[model samples]
Target: MEHCELPRRPGRLDRLRQALPRLFPFLGWWPQVNRRTFKADLWAGLTGAVIVLPQGVAFAAIAGLPPEYGLYAAMVPVVVAALFGSSFHLISGPTTTASLVIFANVSQLAAPGTAEYLHLVLALTLLAGVVKLGLGLARLGGMVNFVSHSVVTGFMAGAAILIATSQLGHFFGLALPRGGSFLETWGALLGQLSAANPWVVAVGAATLACAVVIRRINPRAPALLLAMVAGSLLSLALDGPAHGIALVGALPASLPPLSLPWFDLDTLRTLVPGAVAVAMLGLAEAVSIARAVATRSGQAIDNSQEFIGQGLANIVGSFFSAYATSGSFTRTGVNYDAGGKTPLAAVFSSGFLAAILLLVAPLTAYLPIASMAGVILLVAAGLISVPAIRHIVRTDRGEAGVLAATFLATLFVELQFAIYAGVILSLLLYLRRTSHPHFITLAPDPASPHRALVNIRRSPQAECPQLKILRLDGSIFFGAVNHIAEELHRIVAQSPEQCHILILGSGINFIDAGGCHMLFHEAGAMKLSGREIFFCSLKSEVMELLRRGGCLARIGAGNVFKDKSTAISGIVARLDPERCACCHLRVFDECRARPGGEDVE
Candidate 1:
């Protein structure tokens, strides 16, 4: 019978071709465009524009910016990201987290909504864009993975609570204090519960109820927009004599004008930290969302390209008087559900959003701030992934600890500090786990077993009186040298009769200077004890380490064997022959070949 050879997989060149979109990201999804897809994208864009109407203004308010800046962020950034990004459906715009981070970082430097504040925000956006662009070019997209999923889950949950709590004043039309910690805000809310406006609360409650009902019964329905309209109409109807509900008032009807970010050194310095925080959080959010959506769509995502896309979005958006922007989880999900089939959908959304701004600008006057607060409340609720939290707590204690720490830290400490804490903790835990490698002593099984089967961890088999065999299963790095040396010393001390030690070196992948020193010390101790150390199946890398450390000369080249059987035969021949002569049991074939050798059988 003839045997057929299996075909080899594609080479690196082929893979490179697939990943080449790292340079020109739009190419990643532009191929999906067709007439049918174009139509789908158009409709999806329409839906996105309508959705962003309330979201843009609300997010601007969160960032302490004028409502128009939020709309500006939604427009240019969305178009830039879609055109240059890897994902087909990811829509970039102002997000709640990014907004809050901006406020937290820049609020101390300048008064919110002032010219100085606006200039600093623009500089921040520009700086963030530059950083993101550099990372993409350097192909550092993988670094985002260091921000663990558990940390993200916890941070989002905490941010959600903060978002909801921040909106309490708007929700009830109460004059609660602002700009403090979550606990302080809660305290203020509790203290001012009696000052709440019943009329505003009624409007908020009605909007919230309508949105919830519409979402449950018909997810595709424009529930938020519908809720806003209902709230506005209700406010108008109740405006006759006694109702004291407040509204957003009239908004300017115009396109975002071209603007340059302020270039003052003080402003740049002030915005630098905020820019870095925005860059990290924004890129993490965008890449994560793009990868997730791509997984469901069976499409490959180019992380580097996504980074470039986000960078370009922010860079372009800054000139358009926009603040920091990133991928919106809610908006992206909505786009996918609305049948978006290509990047063009996001572009269309931006265009339609600009067009809608003209007609909807006047309607802003009747849209109650209380109703918008209710929408924010809904967003806050959506951010908390209860199932994910429960799973982390139940499955992994280490990850659960990280989650808890991150959540509490985010609530009390600053946003950037919280992220840094989580990242640092994660790295520390990883290093601690890898610093002590597992070392085991292996011995051949004798009772009707497979060839050379060995017991791990613990075994009752008595080792050969003259030879000791040990197995190491990790890299011999600087961090692990002390632990490995201690284990070897303990084993040698316990079994003094086993003078000659042979190490199974196949599992060792790397060795550092500290590890080399440890090996040298062990070889010297063995030499003093009238014993020898040998290596069987030693890898080339391990041999190099020993040779460089001058330990190989002490161990002797003749004692090292490339094959296990050959090493065993050599060791048996060198064993104390007088002891073998007096032994009743012969464990090796070489024992029988000796002049006075005898077998019990």
Candidate 2:
């Protein structure tokens, strides 16, 4: 027996229930919770918390803030992101990239490790969060797609190099001046090499060696945490500070303290540009990484929701003494690999990080600055994606050029402008490629038994005396309109006797005002010269655009044909019988069927 399914009408309550999940995204997954997932999340959360301990401190140092702020950032923002963002595996925290960007943009206005600097950092975070929230609300998450892969790869490589270079002073125990350009920093470091302390270098080297060995032995090992532990122990054994080695000092233990960001107009003005940069970069990085992880985990992600999550995290985190926080690629990958089952893992990690800090805050007194430098150097090293660079260089010259330019600009120029340069170059090159679209002449294929059209360049077929067949293979936007017009003019110039033109319109995807105006003028000129223009296989969208622009009326609806065979028959019926009879080309069956033309099919 066959059964008919009836459409069920949703009541107001049912509709409201469905809308709840969209508004509060966590509700979608909360009902599916099980013991197995809870256990997995517990383990994943513990792993992530341990991992963030050293990282938070290192990233905080990079951002020119005190050590405790990094942990604070890792806590509040991370939980907020987990509760609100779409990605189950993404862990928001004090990332190396975000920290580096913050320092680069803010260091010029205030001294590092000072009251004024902290205030600026807080304000900057707030502004960036506001910007991000606005963008998410406006549903502009698709903007990240415009930032090309080459640009990101190049920018990351440059940022990595800068990260490593910046840490050279701490690693080598040199009192190098901060806030200098890349070259200037290098120059200052070289000038102060004689003043380098051997004990500090040994501490950094030991940390670096431990991390490398752990990673080589087992890639899944928490190499950073292990290295930091080893370095801190070594520092304690040697009494590092007695030998002129700097230490991170003890961080404050307990919950995040609530504080308002400075709202001075002059300070806000100074931070606006950097805030915008951070907001854009953070969103792009988060969305890209979220999508990438979702590919493996088989999870769906909403970019706009992710943007809002990140924005709220930073906005709320600013009040809790956290600087700008974003999605950390390294931690997110670790979280996924560690069997994190849901956003609960990230939420638990954030909560666990705060609790762990309270218990182990004093232990940081043994963690030398050199050890932090070593960890950051490793981070910088990881950012340089060798495979990505090699692939770009070996595969595409255009993208390689973009990569080279972006990479160079990132190293030597203002980092924000480097992103712009890459995006602009990508667009310009794309337009250049599309503007000069392929305009190939078609002829009947002699190789095929059927009368099929093929490019004249590849086939042995003759052109008809009174007809011209052309193929266009791109959009008819304003940028391409001139070239298309020139090609059309050239076709008429080459074959003046063939007054009727039939264009294969299947390849044309779009037609704008400029394209319509050009077509109108061409059609009018052809009509005046006692000729006609026809379009074969024109798509519905192009037809609609033409109709709306009044080009279809001028050209006549009867001139457009659905298929090439029908178009050929229609054009053949209109061709002069005398010309067809005298023609020896025999390109069409109608010509062959005429009196003088050879009857070849």
Candidate 3:
């Protein structure tokens, strides 16, 4: 054997190129980071940390988990999502919608705040992560487009109402039965209004009023965090525990502790359906928020990569005592406003959150539940977009119907069912519209110098006595084939003497197998009945499909024409000689050379 070394071992650069897709995206940004950007990221991170403390507790309360779990969610998941995700400003953590869904689903199976409830929530996080990762890897980023914006707005509006409803008892200091329906929850509140603890109600009201006033004073200030601090100090002044007010306990640890998601077969089976709903909703939220922020930053977002980042965040977070999370619209806007330059801003945010928690965790022992409720109530209110709702309702009846249906379903039925209902309804309406494509009859116009095909009804032009020309103005798939066939049959039945048929297929954008089979069979039937059928201006893609389906051969390739002029001339040559002689309408230039040989006066 020749002593030639088996092709020189691949260099690091060559190996790196081969492994590009598998590598973390943050590696590419490392070179872009500099001192000024690092300083900007640190300040942005600090702002994010302050913003999340109140939010984390509020969201956790909504999710039926301990207050600390919310803080934990903002930790590892935020870092992982930023490092792997495509958006520079997107910050991932627990969100209002996700939290509400978690409480709605898991609370049905186990008591809120119980160990069993935590396990179910963790399982859902794990399963949802797996599904999200699969969708990303499969490159189904465009799948989210199927979810209409109207449906999303309606669903969120409904969730927002539910969130506000769920917080009423805490805000009012009344102990409410968990998992009650919306109407039932309100009914219960009505009966217990007089029993609310005055001290707790005062704390909640003052916190809410303070947040509002502070926002008005300085739009960019830490209104949520400052209002919460004010509420905590007020509670201390009112002797909160002595006044029968409940406090969110101090966190057990500042660090995200190691944990394992519930992997029990029974638990996984139970949570699978909910996990799917959570994954889809979270993915939609993350992608939409990312793209919206990208518009401001002039950054191009990779939707599939975002899906992968979200999946990994939730998956990794599940093992570190965090719940399912998605990109935060509010936090991302804040990051962009604060001039964050890179994904490192998000990484710094989580780090700062952990460091700050060490100093503030013990202070939470004085943080009233009512104060968290007030902040959450504000968030819930923001979720409902009245202007957007009005726009949808005014501009589109179909979209309005979807919004109403989803909103009602979310309030009355289970949250996941609401998503399914909206999707199915929209799809059904779409199918109904597509199944009945326009079947326009066309004729050659006499007014034009060069004969032009125009709608018969529009121009009132004469058509050949022995040939019926039609233009199908839509795709012909399984759904529309029957409608098309019935229309053709009706036209034929009405004009039995018109034995020759020509289809102008320029308007047929697509034709599936069912469409091809339909044309083939119709051609065979016409041939059997001593008639002929022809098609002209068929698109190349449609022609190729017909050819591949063996339809073109069965229908006779000779009968397929390239243009209206050619098709008219060829079909005219085949028309009954006696009919052509008797016919007065010499509608085509080719027809003038035949029996009806004069141009229109």
Candidate 4:
């Protein structure tokens, strides 16, 4: 009996079903499970959770919230970010900068640790989520491009300094004034130098030294955790309270509780500004880190998707008693280094954190504030990329200026305003550079036998008597129209004898209405002078612009050519033979073939 061949079934529907959850993201990584992966994910998650223990409490303190809130922020937001975000390694949680900014802005309106303050924090988180979600839905992912690399570099450098400085009170165990500017903090530290507690200072110094050494010798070492452990032991050895040292008190054992943001209009109005600041900073940090990792991994990350993920994370987290959450560069780097293969690793990290929290919540009370300060110091040090800063300074002066300005502004001025300043400066500098396109007169090279090399600004070479060749090397937009027009007029004035002009239009990438008008007027002027304007190797887009503007008709279609040789030949044929007979210069091969043409004696 012959068996009939089985028909192949298409898995189109199956593939579609698999892809559907990628947009929502909760279902994307659920299917990729095995014993090995589960174990790996569990370990990665535990590592992340352990890492956040001290960090969560410290960040919460910085944000003017109770210690538990920091843990709360880390718990729910992390899970949401991992589930929804596109990056395999990007773990979202409380960041020091975001926390500090939140405290500085929100503390002005409400008392810290009060119910009103918590409500405001929730409102800020919700608003930030809404803004981020709106941006993602609007496909404004390209907004990140508007933030210059220099601005980020500068801002991060300033933030590093600020972070380090902010921890000085705990680092030295000094009762320093809170919420002061960077300079003010430094001044306060100097003024209160005599009040520094030796025991706290010793713990912080020891922690920092240990972390530094461990990181240098073996980067894989859990330096932060180890340093915290060392500091805590040192504090206990000295009986920290006896030496006027502060400790992080008992932490709550429960998971984040479900809550809603206050719905008062006045509360919303008060929280909006801070929420905007938080959203901007959070998105910047997250998107920058994601892009950096994406570049190295050869993975395409959707910024819009990232925005949505972060927005959802924050929104979900707010209800779960979490403050604003953002991408953590440190954790992301760790995730990548740990060989995390996909977003599942991040999701697993969240799961691990939740499980670890259940077991290790009580142990966090023993972690000293000085030890956390030491970790913050280490993080601050990491933020200042000396090599990258040096490269920026050496390569581009304009960018360096912007970087310096942003750095200073972020330190002295409001953080939001500083970012705005950097963006504005970046745009201004860009406009200044592009407003004057390079308009160079081109001549055949005498040194090169092939006559291919074109000179700009400085050319000792002679020009052809009839045709003047120019290269316009930039977009001919409205901003550049005046500069180009002036340059063209100047070129014509300098070479009055050369009546015909041939523009090598290959470099003219774009032409606006103003630029087209200027070109038309120039062509008209040349024609009135009994000469013709020609374009060789003109791009089709520019040609269309000229055609639509009726420039080609006025300049004559015969004047336009596709190649240099064709243009030279055509111009030679139309040359005033009477003028050519008396002309001693022979600039073209066609001139040598003319009846009156003779080799230059």
Highest TM-score model number: 4
Query: Which parts of model 1 have CA positions greater than 4 angstroms off?
Result: 1-22, 33-55, 58-64, 88-90, 95-117, 168-176, 190-249, 262-278, 284-301, 328-345, 364-382, 447-450, 458-462, 563-566, 578-601
Model 3 lDDT per residue over 376-424, tens place: 6776676677887999999989889999998999899966577678888
TM-scores for candidates 1 onward, in order: 0.81, 0.83, 0.78, 0.86
lDDT of 4 by residue, 1-601 (tens): 9999998776999888877886776576667766776665555565566667767877899899998899888877887887787776788999877898888788998899999889888888989998888888788888888778788788777867876897899899987887688888999999999988888889999988987888788765556667778988998899987777787765566788899887678777877888888898888878867765665578877788889999999999889999998988667655654456667767666666676567776666676788878777876776676887899899999999999998999899876566678889999999988888876777676567656536635756667787788777888889998888888888788888888888888888888788888888888887888877888888899999989988788778998999777888898888888888877767666777664786553
Clashing pairs in 3: none
Alpha-carbon local distance difference test for all models = 0.79, 0.84, 0.84, 0.80
* lDDT tens digits by residue: candidate 2, 119-171: 88999999999999888888887776676778878876776787688789989
| Candidate 3 ranges beyond 4 A from true positions | 1-22, 27-67, 87-91, 95-131, 170-175, 192-249, 260-301, 323-345, 363-375, 386-391, 394-396, 445-451, 456-464, 529-531, 572-599
- Model 4 per-residue lDDT at 425: 98
Error of 4 at 572 (Å): 3.0
**Candidate 3 or 4, higher lDDT?**
3
Among residues 3 or more apart in sequence or in different chains, the pairs in candidate 2 whose N, CA or C atoms overlap within 3 Å are: none
Give the higher-TM-score candidate: 3 or 4: 4
lDDT of prediction 4:
0.80
Which pairs clash in model 1?
Answer: none
